[model samples]
Target: MADIKHFDPDAALETTLRLFWRQGPEATGIQDVVSATGLSRSSLYATFGGKHDLYLAALQRYVEQRSEPTFQRLAEDERGLLAIADFFSELVTARCTGPFARWGCMVANAHAATQNLTAQNADTQVRAILDRHHQQLCQALTQALTTARSLGQLAPGTTPRSTAEVLALLAYGINLRSRNGADAHALNQTMQTALNALTPSRR
Candidate 1:
């Protein structure tokens, strides 16, 4: 008999994540996982508990693997404002060209699916995490505004706080539109408009 490879739990979870990425959680079934991952039912159940549990694990994996990097990089980079723009640009590029473009953001999709479970909690744990992520972005924008001001990149009297707020709004708006299937060109144009608005020459 041929030797069989052991099931990889991480690999299984990633496969599930991609499926959920391509199709929302409610739309994805256990059979879809089985078909995509080629894992036996018993094995999946034994490894990840069940569908809901598996979905959460997959989302956590995505946060750790994908989302965190962008946040961390922007926070640490010098051209942090430009980094934020690039991040949004990357989002547009990913959704425009990646395999899962049409499915929308997993986190946003979860908002519709998991809102009730989180309704009574003292803090919406999911929203808290997302808020923290956005907060880092706002901080990065503040840093960028500072850098821009130092370089005389802004018009006189353009405060860092005001510029930061504008950038943050632009970032959030990009995310909201992207989740609604906005195109890359539309996002790029929006970003450029925001940039032009914040620059001295355009103001």
Candidate 2:
């Protein structure tokens, strides 16, 4: 009988998520996963099914484990707009200074690059996933903006829903720019530009 090994699904999935984040779906191979998780081919197959399934698993893990904190910081924490601003500021700081700055965000990279499938089925699935993530971020931003409005931090007459959409787009843009090797100063300037739009003009 073959030796059955113990595995922690969450930890294994976390490793897989990091691998996929560092390298996109197409670029990551079974051997890479095996190496990262110390799982043999048979174990991986028996446990996770296949590469795509594993990719989906890793994505779910990423959404739950990684995205929740950011969502909380941006949405649940109530410094109104300041929390969002500081989040972006920290993003800028990290991108400019973090050791693995070049890796960028896996979720954003996947959405940006996954739309090129030639087959109809492949195209549909990939596009659906991308759209879903985009809407999720949009909703998160909407919540933050709504909270800011409730707290009177927003400039007068600013609509929470509309501003949220714009801010979500700004956040996406900043992530993309960082992936493109934009520096801290550049990101700071972008943040400033975005904030300026939200700031109320005095009479």
Q: Which candidate wins on TM-score? A: 2
- Tell me model 1's lDDT, rounded to 2 decimals: 0.71
Q: What are the per-residue Cα lDDT tens digits for candidate 2 across 78-183?
A: 6767777887787767555676576666667777766543557655665666676667767767777777778876678888777777876777677778878887
TM-score for each predicted model, relative to the true structure: 0.76, 0.85
In the range 118-167, model 1's lDDT, one tens digit per residue, is: 44441265565556655666676677677767766667778887777777
TM-score of 1: 0.76
Compare the candidates by lDDT and give the number of the best one: 2
In model 1, which regions exceed 4 Å deviation?
1-5, 116-125, 155-169, 201-203
